[model samples]
Target: MVKTIITLLMMIILFLGGTLFGIDQASEGIIQTRGYATADVKEAVQPSRDEAGNVEVELLGKDLQQVTFEEKEQEFQEIESSNFTQKLAGSMEKGVSSFYNLMIQSVYQLVQVFF
Candidate 1:
């Protein structure tokens, strides 16, 4: 029983761990959740005095406009870009969940057998 649980946890961790790479918008693009745009920058609450210490959030323009308030947003009319790497990476990255899920299911079956 202990071995099964340990094995299950190990499988879950290994499945989630990996080098994820790809071209994603450096910021959320206009097409992302249209109604919620976040700020472009902010003060980092963390204690790191690195280069551009300021924190920048990636959000789509429409979302940004909506966030800042539409009346104020209308003044800008429009913004643009296609710098999303994570989304593109998501498209290109291989789906590895199934194999691990199968392993877990197999364990479940084996555990059931023992019971």
Candidate 2:
């Protein structure tokens, strides 16, 4: 009986080890495929700093340009204004919950009035 238990335990350990190794390999393959899909494997270039240690960002490329703080704020506001789906979803959730609460309250009030 002891020998049988030992053999069974060894088989269980081997099976678990193989399962974990397969899982690791599968996850590695997924990560590699994701990296390939993004095509952004190169290391990112760090922003150059000035003598006073102030962070200086140099925007390269033709389409990029440095904007004022007001411009950035306006851009953020525009993005927020354009997010209609998020606002709609939030309002729908609120309406559904409010309706559910109203139904429960009406039931409770009816029971109190009757009994």
The candidate that wins on TM-score is 2
Flag regions of model 1 displaced more than 4 Å.
Answer: 1-84, 91-94
Reference-based TM-score of each model: 0.23, 0.43
Candidate 2's TM-score reads 0.43
lDDT of all predictions: 0.55, 0.81
Question: Model 1 over residues 3-81: C-alpha lDDT tens digits?
Answer: 9999999987776663221123523555365545556433333232335554334343222111346855665544323
Q: Candidate 2's residue-wise lDDT over 1-115, tens digit each?
A: 9999999999999999999999999988987876753365543434665676666554442233346799999999999999999999999999999999999999999999999
